[model samples]
Target chain A: MHTAEVLASRLGLDIAVAELERLFSQPGADPPDYGLDGGHRRPIRVAYQGVRGSYCHEAATTSFPSAAAVEAFPSGFWMEDAFSTLESGSADRAIIPAENSLDGPIDRNLDLLLRHPAVRITGELVVPVNHCLLAAPGVEISDLRRIVSHPQALGHCERRLQSLDLEVEEVDDAAEAARAVAEDRIRDTAVIGSRIAAKEFGLRIMEQSIHDEGGNYNRFLQLGVGDGPLYCGENRKTTVAFSLEKGVSGLFRALWVFESRGIRVTKVDHRPNRANPVRLVNRAGGVELAQMDYVFVVDVEGSELDPRVAAAVAGLGEFSGFVRVLGSYACTCGA
Target chain B: MHTAEVLASRLGLDIAVAELERLFSQPGADPPDYGLDGGHRRPIRVAYQGVRGSYCHEAATTSFPSAAAVEAFPSGFWMEDAFSTLESGSADRAIIPAENSLDGPIDRNLDLLLRHPAVRITGELVVPVNHCLLAAPGVEISDLRRIVSHPQALGHCERRLQSLDLEVEEVDDAAEAARAVAEDRIRDTAVIGSRIAAKEFGLRIMEQSIHDEGGNYNRFLQLGVGDGPLYCGENRKTTVAFSLEKGVSGLFRALWVFESRGIRVTKVDHRPNRANPVRLVNRAGGVELAQMDYVFVVDVEGSELDPRVAAAVAGLGEFSGFVRVLGSYACTCGA
Candidate 1:
């Protein structure tokens, strides 16, 4: 049994055992999930978005419990700063939220990842979200006329907020929302955030676990500099983004590059090409029409170091307009 | 020249001409970009999210200007109500935003479209988004300490908001934000929304065309019921969702169906399978691992009425774990 499985069994968490087993089956693919104490010579510095009580901070902690330091960056344009920190040798690694189990992918982060070629994904972490409704001292639920929190947290507690008949508003961060309620003496408002946020801001916990779903989780990725495709250790997973050449069979031919190699693709996402958003072609007739130019982001099992994976990517270059390797990372199992 | 192109050339709008040409090339696939007065039998009833000055309202107007009634549904869970309105026979059709030029796909609407099989897309409309900064009569840019609007609108004007150094807040709708500012008489805040929203709320337009990009646009789909794959008039495009069977080449085989039929695929998007998010399978060494299950949403250039397209969709049954045709629609082009 793998360490993650053992931890899952011990904690009675609903982690995917079989997935974790496959991920760890590679000779050196095992992740240091418990802590970073065993593998590295020196402590690692990691950067995450928001203040101490933010989920990004929690995710950074969950990814590297014994790191040298966990640094917090401001939210606005912080993803770029986090990547820049890694590139400038200020931080060893950075963690960014990729998607939420309930809400799906985060658009801004996805766009940032696509734009930043310097950073590569090295690992992933899934953090279970538990939202608590916090209020000022001596204020009850009925006294709250409006609710404030991060957009995602507000979305997570949509039902709870609706039931409370509170006007929902969104702020930059949930922790900041709690701080505002505490510092501004806003008695008519409540904030939905982590219990740590309530404690940090000295606010009362009006309600606990107010999220609509109890098993909701957010997936965060560990990003570092350059193409360290070998970071997956024994278990090899590679992520690549590419655009297909112009032809009727262009999309199919591109997918064939991996399918013919017996490589299993885990996910595929398409984004419009920013530089040339629309493709125009002259048909046999004199008709001019607009076509779409899209870049496909795909995850496949096998490290870029593997000859088969390298050949498959090379094969993609034959028919792809643009091909880029995003990263190779060992899959971290979670519910 | 198509009506949309004429309107675009007249307004000097940044609509994608080539795409519009291809879309209209189909004998009956042309959409009335200016108004719905040309083809309809009687005054159509349209339903959209938010109040009169909202984007949804604008999309509905662009779709059908001579509608009998354009009804507004609450922003939260509005898509469901829009579909329900169509399903319950309260409205003739509903239009929902599918994707934005600047932002990626709207996940909630995508999921809703996938979930609700009762509604089928008959046509599509692309509306340019012109974001304006609105405030009270006496308020100026320097006087604003905070700004409130819809999340997407806020995101569109991120650079402008950052430069102003205002406390950004998000409400359910951009129009609602304008209304809130007008009703609450918030002296130190502004709203980023449509000029129509400002007019509706009796607020002053502090700034015009404040979007980060000049050519921002959103694509909205026209939906009805009962698989009117034949509704495309002379132009026909089909949208289908399918999950590949458990095999290395399952995905490739599914795409081959369309490619072999000489059909051009316009777009492809993959979403995590909600029913079975993670798939566990046995590898060559009899070791079990967790794999992922995803459903692909694809757009192809032929209507279901086309025998080739029908055969291809039918062929999907051989290798797809699940398959569903979302709708067939005539495309309206925009950047």
Candidate 2:
């Protein structure tokens, strides 16, 4: 009997033994290829938004454990700066938070991905978020009158912060908020940030893991310039963005191409097409319908190099106004 | 010849005449029912985040032109407060921004919608966003050292603001930024906001329509307590949220039900399932896979009362762990 089945039986879990066997028998359980060449021509540098102790910085370091340097960009407000750094060849890879389990998609990065066509998503890292309330040393919880953090972090801990009854202030970065509290000696203000930020800024962690719920995770994507390498593996996931040629049945037909090919779609999202924002659909009664054009981004369970995936993309091109394969990378098994 | 055909031919547009005819022949182009009882029980009070000059305020007033009272909530940071007002019977309706053309989905409100099950979306309005640069009276543009506005406004005007080379500060609301500039007499800071905000706050318009690109719009949804009325119309659009019982072919099968029923899906989005955030998939080799669970939200081109839509939703329930019909309302044709 499989170890998983034994464990499930012991735990009285209703999971099927056949499903466990299938999952274990799946190939390509190896670590994902981040498209890094082995030769060390120069020290590898990864660029990420925010200062050294931010969650993004932690994502960068964790994604590239042995990287020689992790460069920090001052502005967390704009994700474009990180993309530009990668596009300009200043950094080997740029890591940006793509989505939060609680807050959903980090849209600014998604928009930047569409805008920067050359940048390819090479790998993804799912970091468990544990927001901490940090304040200056010698400050008690009762002394706090206000709380500060990034909008996403604040949102993650909204219920906790509301119970605290502190005035909430949003900044571009959680580490910046921690730095402000520490450097400015704001005894009355606490920041919702990471433990790393508290340690780096010499601030006391008043509360640890203060997020509203357990299992908070942030998915971060590692982006590299151009098409670096094709991931050849069974557990590969390909992301593509496309716009439909027709209105009503466009998306249905678009997804049909994959379904007919026996491809499994993992996720689907839509973003407004920045280049072609509107389409004027004129009617018989002179009623001009200005419809918002959308670019649908989908993730399928195969690499683009796979024959089936290639054929499915080619088929998508038939009915789509435009289709671009963003990237195909090995899927991470767990957070 | 139809007027649309004549206009298309004169403008040298490659639009098909048959398509135009079909569009015009489509039924139900009447204005939507806002769910107002048309009784004088009490002044129709609508609650929205931000003050009178904010975008949410504009969406509320525009959605209900004859609303006697528009209540302003102080906290624009949290969308939950606006929803709570409607849930607690403090307001008859609540209006909140759903999506922005350039910035994409307003995720906070989407998260709030999932949390507040009792609140139902009754109507929608697409407001054209015309952002302006506001500053203190008699303050020249050259004298400004910093710019302040809501994060979305700052993002929309990023390119224009980058060209100005001023420090940027993000506030909770654009109107609040304008108010700060006017009330505090901040001569060195300009704000990216609306003309309404400038007029209300007594700030001068430094520049008009300062957004980066044209066709800027914000889609707003009006929410009320419970399912007030079943929209019975040809142009009705229904929004639904569901979570699949299985993975892989789950979403495809879900969409297939709608497509087979001839229901046109207008939009698709995914939100993290807060109640059940993670699913533990155990494998034979003792590899435990913790996958993030998601709730899929879809908008289809029919009301729940429509038999076809109802049948499709029932079909969805067969394979869905959870299903919710958020609302059905008349479709807004243009921005």
The residue-level lDDT of candidate 1 at B282 comes to 56
Clashes of each: 14, 0
In model 2, what lDDT does residue A175 have?
Answer: 85
Query: Please, what's the RMSD in Å of model 1?
Result: 10.4
> Candidate 1 has what TM-score?
0.69
- Residues B38-126 of candidate 2 have per-residue lDDT tens digits of 32122445677767678777655555433332334433446887787887777766777787776677766667777889988776666
Q: Model 1 in CAPRI terms: which quality?
A: incorrect
- Which residue segments of model 1 deviate by more than 4 Å? A1-41, A50-81, A125-218, A229-234, A244-249, A280-292, A318-321, B1-42, B65-77, B130-172, B176-215, B229-235, B245-249, B281-289
TM-score, first chain, each model: 0.76, 0.79
Residue ranges of candidate 2 with Cα displaced over 4 Å: A1-43, A64-78, A130-213, A247-249, A281-289, A333-335, B1-41, B64-77, B132-172, B177-195, B198-213, B282-288, B333-335
Q: Write model 1 residue lDDT over B16-100, tens digit each, in one string.
A: 2222333323423444443333433223456675565777676665544332323334333466777888788666567677777
Whole-model lDDT for model 2 versus the true structure?
0.71
Candidate 2, residue B43: how far the Cα is off, in Å: 3.7
lDDT for residue A116 in candidate 1, whole number 0-100: 86
Which candidate wins on DockQ?
A: 2
Number of the top-ranking candidate, with TM-score as the measure? 2
**Weakest 10 consecutive residues of candidate 2 chain B by summed lDDT:** B13-22
Q: What share of the reference contacts survives in each candidate?
A: 0.16, 0.45
